[model samples]
Target chain A: MSTATGLRRLTPSSFLLFVAVLAVAASAAALIVVYRTGGGIISDQERAEALAERDLLEQVDVEQGLDTLAAGVTRRALFATAGQHFGLFDARGQALAGDLTTFNPEFRNADWKVVRVGVKPRYTVHVIGSTLNDGAVLVVGRSLSNLRRFERSIFYGFASAVAIVAVAGLAAGLVMNFLILQRVDAIANTAERIAGGDLSARSPVADGRDPFGRVGVSLNAMLERIEELLTGMRTVTDSLAHDLRSPLTRVMGALARAMHEGATEDERMDAVEVAHDEVERTLNTLSAMLDIARAETGLSREMMVRVDVAALVEELADFFTPVIEDAEQKLVIHAPSHPVIAHGHEPLLRQAVGNLLHNASQYAGEGTVVRVSVEENQDTVDIVVADTGGGVPEDQRGRVQERFVRLDPARSSGGSGLGLAIVAACAKLHGGVLRLEDNHPGLRAVLEIRRV
Target chain B: MVEDDAEVADYVAKGLRETGYTVEHVPDGRDGLYLASSSSFDAIVMDRMLPGMDGLSVVKALRAASVETPILILSALGQLDERVVGLRAGGDDYLTKPFGFSELHARIENLVRRRAGRSVETVLRCADLEMDLLARKVFRAGKPLDLLPREFKLLEYFLRHKDRVVTRTMLLEQVWDYRFDPHTSIIDTHISRLRKKLDEGFERPLLHTLRGVGYRLSEQP
Candidate 1:
C-alpha cells in the first residue's frame, strides 16, 4: 500500500491541491481548443468581403474621381495601396480590392467601411449606389489583425484566470487542512502524549457540530472516564494502607499482650490462634486490595495477549466439579464450540472466576445448581457465575460489589466482604463492566469484558 | 502539657508516670498555659488542638517568655501542615496520637537530657572503675563488659549525667519511648536487669533505687 493508504498517509491538503491544479489545467486546454477551432468562421467572412470588393473594382476606375493631385495613381494601385493602411468599402457594402479578397455569403449585405482617396478630387465613381454601375461598394481591408488580437486576449485571460484560481486553491487548501486534518492532528498529538504516559493530557474539544468536533467530544468523554477511574484507584490504595494498618495494630497488640501476660498455656495458645487469624485476615485484605487496584488503573490495554475464554470456563468447571459433587449440588458449564478468546491476564481472570465458583459452592445450598457460562456476543465477552441461592435484592446489588460489602449470609459465614468488589474493580480496570441481576430464582453476576 | 482529647491525655499521662515522670495533667489550653507559667518542667508535651488557647498558642507563649524548655508536640492530624504548625511553635519534636508509647517516652527523655547541657564533662566511674570512650568500649579491671542494646544505651546516658541525679522519667525518655504515667513497673523492671548484668558479681551495686520517687544511676557504691 502507498503511504497514503491504511494508517500512515499523505494529508488531505496535498491531495486537494493536486485535484484543484489538475482541474484548472484541464479547463484551460478545452476552452483554448474551442476558441481556435470553431471561431475560424469570423476570419472566413472577412476574406469573402475582400473578394466581392475586388470584383466591383474590376468594373470601375475608382481613383479617377481624384484631381490633378492624384493623376499618377491608377484605380487598382490606389485601392490596393490604401488596403495596406485600412479596409475600404463603396456604397454596395463590399470589399473591392485587398488581401482580404472574399465577401462571406453570411456577411454579403452587411455595411462595409468605405474609404476614398483625395480631398476635393471631384470623386463620383467611388459611391455606394447604382450610379457606380456595380460599383455598389468596395473596401480594401487589412488581413486578420482583429482576429489575432481577440485570440491573444483570450490567451491572456486564460493565463490570468488560471493563476488566480491556483492562488485561491492554495488558500482554500490551507484552510481545509487546518479545519479538517489539522484538528485531527491536534487530537492525534494529544493521544500520542497520553500514550507516552501523560494521563493528564486531554484533546482540545471544538464545537460538536462537525465530525472532527464530535470526535473531540467523544475522546474527551473517554479521557474523563479514564482520569476518574485512575484517581479512584489511587484513593483505594491509599485507603488500603490507612484503613488496613489501623486494624492490624490492634490485632498485633492483642497478640503481643497475650504472649507477654497470658497466665497459662491454654491462654497463650488461644492468643496465638487469634493472632494467626488476624494475620490471615490481613493477607486476604491485601490480596483483594491488589486485585482492585490493578483492575482500576487500566492495566489491561497494555497486555492484550489472547486467552481462550471458553477453555477457561471449562477448566474452572472441571476444577470445581468435585466440590459440587461433594456438596450434592449440580454444576454445569456452557461454552461455545469455537474457542472464544479475550485479551486478559489469564491468572487474574481465572482467580476471578474461581472466586465466583467458590462463592457459589459455599453459599448455594446442597442439591442446588451452580450455573457457569462464558460466551461471546459480537463486541463483548461475558463470563457469568450464577447461584441458586437467594438472589441479591435490587437495592442491595449495587452496594454488594463495593469494597467490604457482603450480604447478610456471606457476612455471617465469615466472609471478608471483598469478593464481588474485587471482581467489579477488575472489570473496570480492563475497561470492562460487571452486571448484577436476578436469575428469577437466584442471583446472576456477570463479568462483561470488552473484546479488544 | 497535652490538653486535647481526654482519652489520649490520660493514656499519655499514665505512661509518663510509669516511666518515672512527675506529670501535671491539664484539660484545655487555658489551664495548660496557667500550669506551664506557674510550674517548671524539664520538658512539655503539647497537644496541637486544645480547647481554648490551642497547643500552638501555648507553645508560642512559652517561647515568648524565653522559656527554653524542651517542648514536644502531640497531634492527631498526621498531615504535613499539623507538623509545620507544631515546629513553627518551637516544639523540639512532633508525634501524632495512635503512636507507640515507647517512642513518645524515649523522645521526651532525650529532649530533657539534652536540655540539661552541663558545661563541664564529668568522668563517671564506680569502685576504681575506669574506661576510655575514645577506644569505643568500656572496661573494669582490664576486663571488657558485654552489654546488650538497652543496657549500653542506659549506661551511656548515665555516664553523660555522671554527677547528677538521673530520674527514672529521664531514663525512660532517654531509653524507652513510653510517654504515659501508667505508674507501671517499667523503669524498675529494666533497671533490675541492667544491674544484674553490670554489677551482679561485684561487691557493691552502683545502681540505686529511690522509693516513691525514682531510680538513679550513681558512681558510688
Candidate 2:
C-alpha cells in the first residue's frame, strides 16, 4: 500500500498526461498524412514515365513498321540503365529483342501494371504492353525501388518522432511531479510536527507568491493563533489556581476558627461572616474570569446592539459620582450634547466602563479629579476614564491589563485583579482595544469600540 | 420549584417555606410541567437542566398551553446570551446557579408581584416621601427634592417595590438596566446619596440597609 501511494505521488497529474497524449496523437496524425501524400506522388511519377515510354514505342511501330520498332527496342535495351527495360515478342510469343526476359499475359494490353522480372535479384516494375498491327508485342517498364525507398523513409521518420515525444513527455512529467511533491512535503512535515506536540512548528514555504505559498502562509498563521490561545489558556489556569487558593484558605481558616471549642457566640458569628465574605469574593473572582473568557471568545457578541456611547458614559458617571465623592475624589464628565452611538454589547460595555471607574476610585487617592469623557470619530467611539491622582507607572500599565497581575502585593484594594482584564476582553469583543495611557499625573484608560 | 438535584430542590423548597410560601417541589421537568399546567402557582422556579425534559422545553410547553404563571429560570448557564435565551423561552426571569437564597426570594417576589398586575399608580408614598411618576419628581415632607435622572429612577424603583426586600443584583438590573456585577460598592454609594436626600432632616429613616443581603425601603423600618 505504501509503495502504491509513493508511486502515485511520484506520477504527474492525469491532466498533464492527457495533454501529452493529445500532443503525441496530433503528431502521429500529421506524419501519417505526409507519408500518404509523398508515396502517392512518387508512384504517380513512376507510372507516368513508364506510360510515356510505352506511348513513344507504339508511335514508332505505327509510323515505321514492326521491324523498325523491334530494332529500336533492341537499341534502347542495350543503352538502358539497371532501372530501364524493354521487350519485343513475335506472334508465337517468342522474345524478339530486350533485356527483360519474362512477361505476364495481362501485360499484352496497353495498360500499366506492376510485374516482377529478372533472376538472382528480383525487381518490381511498372510495365505497359501493346500488340503491334503485324501481330507482334512491345513492352516498356520502370523499376518501383525509388517509391518503396520513399515510403520506408517516411515510416522510419514517424517512428523516431513518436519515440522522442514519449521520452520527453515522461521526463517533463517526472520533473513536475517532483516539484509538486516538494511543496506538499513541506506542509505535511509541519503538520506532522504539530500533531506530535510541537506547537511552534511552522511551514518554511510561506512565500505568498503562489497558491502553494499562500496555503503555507495561512497554515502558519493558523498555527500561530493556536499557539497563542494555548499559552493564554495555560496562564489563565495557572493564575486561577493561584488566585483561588488564598481566599479558599482564608475561608477554611475562618470555618476552623468558628468551629473551635469554647468559642464565644459573637466570635463565631464574626468568623462565619468572614468566611462568607471570602467565599463571596472568591465566587466573584470566578465569575469575572468566566466573563473575561466569554468576551475574549466572542461568546457575548450576540448581545450586541446599538447603544448611545455618550448616554452610557454619562449614566455611568452619574452612577459612580457618589462613590468617587465618598472617596474624597471629585468626579466630572465631558461629553457632547449630541449622542455618540455605537454598535456594542450594552451590559459588557457598561461593566467595562464601570470597572475603569472603580479602578480609578480605588487607586486614585483623595482630592483626585476623575474625569469621564466620550469622544466620537467616524467609525469608532472612545470612552476615556482619566484620573488626576498618582498614576500607574509607565512600565506597569500593560501588565495591569493581564489577569491576576496586581501591583499591590498585599491586595489591600479588595479587587479581584481581573477588572482590567474584563475591560480588555469587552473592548476586544467590540472589535476595539483598551489602551492604558498616562493622565499626565494619573492613569487614563481609553476604551475604544467600533461604531458600526 | 423544578430541579433535578435533590440538594438544590431541598434547599430552595425549605427556604421558600420558611419565607411563608407554600412550596411544591418537582424533581423532573415533565412532572413540573404537569403540576404547573394542572394546578396554579404564584411563581415557578425552573432549573435549566432536568431529567424527563430540559427546562427550556418545559417553559416553552407551558407557555404554548397558555399557562401564564411567572417562571424564574435557575441555571448554571450564566452567560449573557444564555440569560437572553432563557427569558426568550417564556421565562419571566433568569437567575444563575450558586445564587444566595435572598436573591432567589427577592426575584421570585418581584416576579409574582409583577404577575399580580397592580394598576399603575401616579403617586408613590412611603410615609411622607412621595414620588410623582408622570412628573418624574420626588418630594419628602411635601418639599420638592431635587434628584438626578438616575436618582429619580432609583427612587421610583424603591417606591414601586416599597416594603419588599430588594437585593443588589435586583436593583442593578432594574434601576440601571445593568446585568453585570460591579466589584465596587457603587450601588451602596448611590443608595446612600438617595438616603441622604430622602431623610437628611427627617426623624425617621425609610431606607434601611440589610447587612450581607441588600436594602429595604419601608415606613415601618
Candidate 3:
C-alpha cells in the first residue's frame, strides 16, 4: 500500500468521485446507443413475423386442394425464411401437420413457450380459434439467436468502456492525492524545524492560493511573532544587566576611594554602610530574577512531606517577635491546638513566611500589630500574615507579586522589592498559592498549600 | 568584614564590635586567614573580594585545613549563583555587602552560635547550676533541677550570653539556629521556658530581658 501510494496514490474519496462522474457519462452514452440500435433490431423482428403470416396464407391450400408440386414449392419458400418453424395440433392436441419436428402432446396446449429449438432459446406463441375446421391450432416459434448476438456485442462494448473510465479515474485521483500529500508533507517538515528551534524556518509556499500557501503565510507570521518576543526578552535582560552594573561599579568605586583617601573612622563607616546597602540591593535583584527563572520551569516542588503547620507558625511567631518588637511593631501569632500539617518543602515555606514578616515591617506602620495565623482543614492548610500599613492598591497588588514589578518606587522604600517576589516564588515552589486580599484597614497575604 | 575596601571593612567590623562581639581587622584574605588560623576567633568576618585570595577559596582552605572557625562570607557577589558558590565552598553563612549593620551583626552572631553548638560542651552550666551531658541531669547547686530539653538550651544560651544584653535575634540565633524562619517568636517562647525553669521557686532570677536589646544571665538577682 505504501509502494502504491509512492507510485500512484489514490485516496478512496477522490477515486470514488472520479469514477462516479465517468460512469455517469458512459452510462448515458450506452443508453443512447442501446435505444437507437434496439429500435431497428426490434422492427426487423416484427417484419419477420409479418412475413411468417404471409407464408402461412400461401400454404393455406397446400394440404387440401393444391397439387403436390405446388405444395412442395410453397413449403420450400416458407422454410427458407430465417425464423420459420411450424406445427399443427388437433382439438385433442394431437400432431396433425409438421416437418422436421418431434411431438410432445402435453406441451402443445400451452399458450406461450420458452422453447429451445435448434440450439437456441426463442419466444413463441400458439393460438386456437373457432375458425379452424377441426378446432386445431398451429404452434409456431422463431429463433431469437440473432437478437442475442446483437445484445451481446453492445453489452461487451459497455463493459469495456466502464473499465477504461475506472482506470482513468484512479490514475487522475492518485496523481492529485500525491500532489496534495507532498505539499502537506512540506508544511509538516517546516513545522518540525521550527519546533527544533529554527525560528527563521518557514513552510514552502505553494504556487497558487491553496490552503497550504495560506498556512505557510500564517506560520511565517507566527514565527515572526515568536522571534520578536525572544528578541525583546534578550534586549530587556541586556539593559537590566547594563543598568545594574553602572550603579554597582560606582558604589564599589566610592567605597574604594574612601579607603584610599584614609578617611576618619566615621567617614569610612558611612561609606561602608552605603556601599553595603547598594550591594545588597543588587543581590536581591539577582535572586529575584533567579527565582523567577526557576519558577518559569513550572515549579518542580520536590520532597513534599507532611508538615506541622501550627509548629511552623508558632516557630515563626517566636522568631520574629523580637525583631518586630525591636522595630516597635506588635507581633501576634495565632495557631490552632491541633497540628495543622501540610505537605511541602519546609525551607521554602519558611522563606515565604520570612518574606511576609520582612515586607510588613518595611511597609506597615512601625507600631501597628502584625498578626500571623495558621488555619488548617482536612485537605489544605493556610498561613495568613496581615499587616496594617499603606496597603497595596488593588491594581498594584498583583504586579507586586512579580519580580522587579514593585509599583511603589524603590527610592521611597528600604526594601529591595524582592521580598514579595520571593514570597511568590516560594509559594509556587511549594505547590501553594499566595494571594493579597483586603484586610479592611490593612493588607492580608495568605499562603495556602494543599495537604498530602 | 576584613575587607580591603577600608570603608566597608571598618563599618562591618565596628558594627560587629558594637554589637558586643570582639572583631579583629584584616584587609586581605592572607592576613584574614592568618589571623583566623593563628587565633581561634569566635567568628571570622570574611570579605569575598580580597588582595591575596578570594573569600570562597579562603573559607574552602580553612575548612580543608580543619579550621573550625565559623566564617560569615561577606561579598558584593549578590547573585544567587554567587551565594550558592560561597555557601558550597564551606562558608558557614553568607552576607551580601551593603548589608544593614543590624543584619550583619545578626548574621555573624547566628553563624557563631550555630558553630558553638556543634563542638561546645553539650552540658551547659550557669550560676549554681550544673548540667551533666551524659547523665542528662540538671542540678541547682548540687540539688537536682528538673527542666525540659528546651529549658536547658534556653538556659545554656543565657549562660553563654552571661551579663550582656542578648537581643531576641541573639537568642533565636543562639538557641534555635537550625530554624530558618526569622518571622516567628521561638525566642520568646524559649525565654519564658527558661524563666519558668530557672526563676521558679528560686530566690534568684537569672534570666532577664533587656527590653529592646535582649536577655541577660547573671547572679546579681
User: What is chain B's TM-score across the candidates, in the order shown?
Assistant: 0.55, 0.96, 0.63
* Model 2 residue A96 lDDT score: 85
Among incorrect, acceptable, medium and high, the docking class of model 2 is: medium
- How well is each residue in A4-94 modelled by candidate 3, as lDDT tens digits? 8744776656566856786868676876789577956764665456456535643564446233323443465456566555555456655
Model 3 segments more than 4 A misplaced: A1-243, A246-250, A269-281, A303-306, A335-343, A375-381, A410-412, A430-433, A450-452, B1-123, B126-221
Predicted candidate 2, C-alpha RMSD: 6.5
| Residue lDDT tens for model 2, B27-82 | 99899999999999999999999999999999999999999999999998776667
The weakest ten consecutive residues by lDDT in model 1 chain A span: A122-131
How well does candidate 2 score on lDDT at residue A78? 94
Please provide, for model 3 over B31-123, each residue's C-alpha lDDT reduced to its tens digit, 9 standing for 90 to 100. 777777778778787888889987777898889889988878887755434555677789876766565666666566656666655565757
Pitting candidate 1 against candidate 3, the one with the higher DockQ is 3
- Candidate 3: deviation at residue A185, Å? 8.8
Indicate the residue-level lDDT of B102 in model 3. Answer: 60
